[model samples]
Target: MARGCDGSEAGARLRGIYRTKQSPIFLPDFLRSRIHVSVCALICVVGGWPSGTEERVIQPVSNEEIISLALDEIDGERRAEVAGRIAASPDASRTLAAVTIAVQTMRADDSISPPGEVVQRVLGLMRSGVRVRTSLMDVAGQVAEQVREFLCTLVRDTQSEPALAGFRGTTESRHLSFECEIAEIDVQVSRGEGEARRTIRGQVASLTDDTVGRIAWRSTLTGAAEREIAADESGVFVLECPVGVYELSARVGGSVVRIPPISVA
Candidate 1:
């Protein structure tokens, strides 16, 4: 029978290697006794397991880092250190090369130029001081039939001048007018002092009937939900807001009409 022993340094080290008592089932007693000796010999041959308060020997470089290095975004000592690591790794070097080739190919491609007439038309629209934004409900099938009827009414709706330029000195008020098959809407915008901010005073009246409904304004710049404005018995309403572009919507009877974006500035 094998000799039974008390806890000692050699015995404790062997216990650490074969943690489970059932390890004796897989290995014979003779082989189990050599577990500590084999572990020490392997460690001494390989210079010990990688551990301690030393810098890591292997550091992974990400694809974003490789792209940044290729773009010349890094500089000085840090750049040099990362460059050395990238040079030592074959995968990082290949990624940098591929990104550099793609950038060079893009730079070598020819530029595209728009047609002269198209450019002139865009310039004219900007110069006219008229910023027209398309209505969303009109794009959907909701206002398709009404759009054709309103477009014909728009020809007759053209009034004296743009509301943006109508404001006089000190008060800085502007009047905008729009007509459709449903209603003829007129809005007066002006800047307010102190706590009042800016205000939009408007009136909506039916072009075909006596029916009147609600009007609301949504700030396009802030991307907020439309705020409902209550109108008087005479079909007049007032809205106060900060200086920004806005889109107005009026619901009269079963018809809902949305105006284009109006810039406050």
Candidate 2:
């Protein structure tokens, strides 16, 4: 006598039952009853057949959720489920990819240094009421002046240095200093090879004691060439542009400090 069928045999038997149900051939009443009982038992063993209402409902993922997923805020089983949903949705997948790229770019930008201690001290002084007493009209006038564009007078240059032995060998770098009532800017331009771009390094410092802590500045190059860069905490910045005549501007606080057109060769 053979033992009962195993899982594979049971599956085969189930398939046979299905085929039997579809067949028009006549079958004994006893055999039909046994097939029906077996199928019912199999259904119970498998936790019952799935009903029409038991289908999985896919909910659309929102952009915020997708951003959180890209940031790795979602983890474990939920991460897997969200990833599956995103894979199934073209729009969601594109959004996830774009958000991931932007997150990476922001992480890269985090390497920039934060505001220096001088800025902190300035804030402390303002909080302590150590600033000058100014009338509201005076304050308004100052703000208006700051918003206007003003030229910075060139105070010094490398050419001002006395020639050594009446002859100075050619150099590739030029140093310049410009000053205004608000701040002073020092710049160094390094000349590159023929037709190559020039590297400009500069620093901005406050001219008045009250403005010493306002170190946040932005440098911009415009005209025959164009580039812009934010100064670090120490009011230092570097920029590069092709050989051309450009007007350099440093926006310190609300003031726009404009320098004369600089020709680089």
Candidate 3:
């Protein structure tokens, strides 16, 4: 058996049903239908309808939301709803256009991957619990620092013989030397017999008795720095490379010293 509704109680129940129907809250179809019946009964008893129809206001979508929608993150029904709003409102369309243009402009800027050695160093630091800045501006700063650290300033360069006079023979070799804070670099460049590429031999030495353990060469033209040659106990190393500009790097003691760029041609 169900309890019957008294006059005041019935009025209060009718008001609640009408409020549920007009509220923004979502309801299932069966519950909505039951509420509709109560609203109609109340309307008949009161002999009038509600003052006015409730209006549904659309909230403005944020820029972040627009970007998410462009990225296809908002899917299915929500995607349709957002797309419809964007298409209907000129302001929303303009906002989406601005965001698209900004993203395209950023991608159009020149970008290059850092060298493999730099990447390894950064990864090692992170593994050792060193904190690295992750902002866009910080990326440029970090890359600049990496490049600066690898590039040693040229203190002096000495050429053995003059090219114009040709004092030696056609197979003459030239010697060039450079001095940095960590080490002094001596390099010899000469053409190989019957070979197309040239031969480069170098030595890295420090005044304070720090032995150079490793020497690596990077070709500016090919952007390759794969092979790392080991130096002798006296810090002497040799390499056969193509005719191009190269950047030589050596690891001495606890510091890495980078010699200035050299050209074989």
Candidate 4:
């Protein structure tokens, strides 16, 4: 039998095959150690793993965290880490961008002012650390006891203005303002999508305090069905009805404010 090749010669042959073929092959124990070292070196060079550097770990950021970041509530080294991770994640980056834009927009928008008494009450409660909770029925009873009816008087009407009478053409829109003891109502009547239909858009502002919440309102067109809608938090409401005279009413706070019949043509 021919003498077996020496370990050095066998190892060199195995390394040559590994380099040329770039595929797995059975190797002797000594050859395996040599090949492992060569493979590691090749990987460091080809896979862009710099020596003595640890790989970065990316963690997901939550929506609340992103919002806090936008609000500048986060600070120090943690903020930097979170920002880096957010930058690495496309979805998180987009969400953060959207939240930032929304915060900026809200900052630029108008804000409602609460009554001074309400603010003082809130501050007092905060200082005292007392929580005042009222039952729904109790609140309803209080509202009922304070409820009163008032007939709003027309304060201004562009249609009836003598100065505009000469200039008034066949306009499709009209503006009216009414006032009562508790609130003021500004209404815009416009032609609706359908023929012989009218759209009424109105805003109610409390004279005593800010309109705190949604208020129930109704419109009754003469000889037609009544339409009921709730005003938005800002006390804005819209109604569509056939072209006819309408009596509108809004239940604001403890008061029922009613407007006289107004013709919509």
Candidate 5:
């Protein structure tokens, strides 16, 4: 029916089980008892893991079957690796089974990055041709509850007076209202050559010196060149700016701190 990426070869992308849509057949309990029990046993074996024993390593009978089996591993690290392998296959990616692996792996360890936007991108790519996984629906629902906040913050007016930029404001998250300031800065550029290739680093600090955040470096280089940066945690960032005297600053709490310009050349 379905399969995992490892051991078994990836099969066709499933549109999912179509019962009535394809004119399904109804069978009597007495006639289907043997088949039903076998299916139920398989479900139990795959869905119940770690805590549930009686596990025997064997070929994954179906896509959902092996995915559930891989997810059963007691160790999240192992599960992530196994699940990642399975998700890479079109056969496994088409089912909610894939989302389950990603979410469970992340929930086991928040330090894991696959549970966030990375999952979103994968689901987005899969949904292009397959049925949406039910397991992912709840995550989508909770995120949608506050869609307006992200939309408003992502789109802001920078031309108005400082107060009207829409980037400086307070946002209500959970039960607390937090002060937020957003800005778009030109990327930092670096120069130099060979082992002497110049580099720059930027950091934002709280006035109390409690929290120091690095900036995400990304900019178009004109004279010199800029480095592209990526970080899993973006709340605060340290950016590497190339060589040049430029304006740089970041907002912490309700205030913005501007760093005096520095030159690498």
Candidate 6:
């Protein structure tokens, strides 16, 4: 081994010591618990935990490799090695590092346990929230609203497509259009047939809304199970119940419309 001025150790002894040492010089105390990175993020307490808030810097690893490794599915020594690498240097400055870790954790596992202290705290927030760099509260709110709009488009597309397979297949497209159906609000059921029918037909004039026909159905598009919902005058709107099984009473314009369950099955 070529010796450096810093007194570099070489060969088998070095590899063995690095892998098996309980206290490698580079390993952060916070990561020594051998806790799963996910759990470590969640259960890591502030004061009692090995590292203090001031010592909690995960920095100076200019390469993204350490971040990738820290987030890998490995446990024990491998995970420790990755975190240690990230925390090794003092001058690293990737502003997104913390947020990146949090998002990666969630994207990696949905039910990831949070490490109770700082890292986990940020993880929990990012789970149900988005990270915004905006300093203005109004701008932050607007950004959130815009995000919601985009998200609703996705959710509605997902929910509506499967529910309306017979009606259309605009699920994957970014934009879709369909002629609206002018139907009345009503529900009908035939127990003899073990079937329930919900008719979005009737007085179309009195029950029309901007959403009428633009959206295919008024029920939640669930399985052919029992669902409850109110139909607008034009019987166009979002549904709280799934498909086919008509519900008992749906509130429309603050009024309840009761009908025997409808069965599409």
TM-score of each: 0.39, 0.38, 0.40, 0.41, 0.20, 0.18
User: Is candidate 2 or 5 superior in lDDT?
Assistant: 2
Better of 3 and 4 by TM-score: 4
Quantify all predictions' global Cα lDDT against the true fold. 0.60, 0.58, 0.60, 0.62, 0.34, 0.32
Off by over 4 Å in 5: 1-197, 209-241
Worst 10 residues of 2 by lDDT: 128-137
Error of 1 at 32 (Å): 66
**lDDT of the structure predicted as candidate 5:** 0.34
- Can you write out model 1's per-residue Cα lDDT over 1-265, one digit (the tens) per residue? 1111233433443443354333333455677668656655554555554357123333455565677788899999768866886898898899999999998888897988888855664444332222211242333355544532222122222224444464535346777777776788787878766454778888877776656555667766555556778899667988778876776766566566556566665
Q: List the residue pairs that clash in candidate 1.
A: none
Per-residue lDDT over 1-265 for candidate 4, one digit per residue giving the tens place of the 0 to 100 score: 1111333423333343443222346456677787656655554455433445232223346676688889889999768866886898899899999999999999998988998865664444332211111121133465654556666899999877754555557675789999988888888899897998888898887787635343333223223333455677777888787775566656566556667667678
Which stretches of model 6 miss by more than 4 angstroms?
Answer: 1-60, 73-82, 88-265
Q: Which stretches of candidate 3 lie over 4 Å from their true place?
A: 1-171, 193-195
lDDT of 5 at 32: 52
* Backbone clash count, each prediction separately: 0, 0, 0, 0, 13, 22
Ranking by lDDT: 4, 1, 3, 2, 5, 6
Best by lDDT: 4
Candidate 5 or 6, higher lDDT? 5
What shift in Å separates residue 46 of candidate 5 from its native position after superposition?
99
Flag regions of model 2 displaced more than 4 Å: 1-146, 160-162, 193-195, 209-226
Tell me the deviation in Å of residue 111 in model 4. Answer: 58
Q: Would you give me the overall lDDT of model 2?
A: 0.58
Q: Write the per-residue lDDT of candidate 5 for residues 1-265, one digit (tens) a residue.
A: 3232221221111111111122143344464556544544554555432243223222223444444554563346645644564555566555646557676787787563565754654444323212112222222355533321100011222222254356455421111011223332322234434343444432332434323232222221131222223332333333434443333333333333332222334
Better of 2 and 4 by lDDT: 4
Candidate 6, residue 78: CA error in Å? 5.4
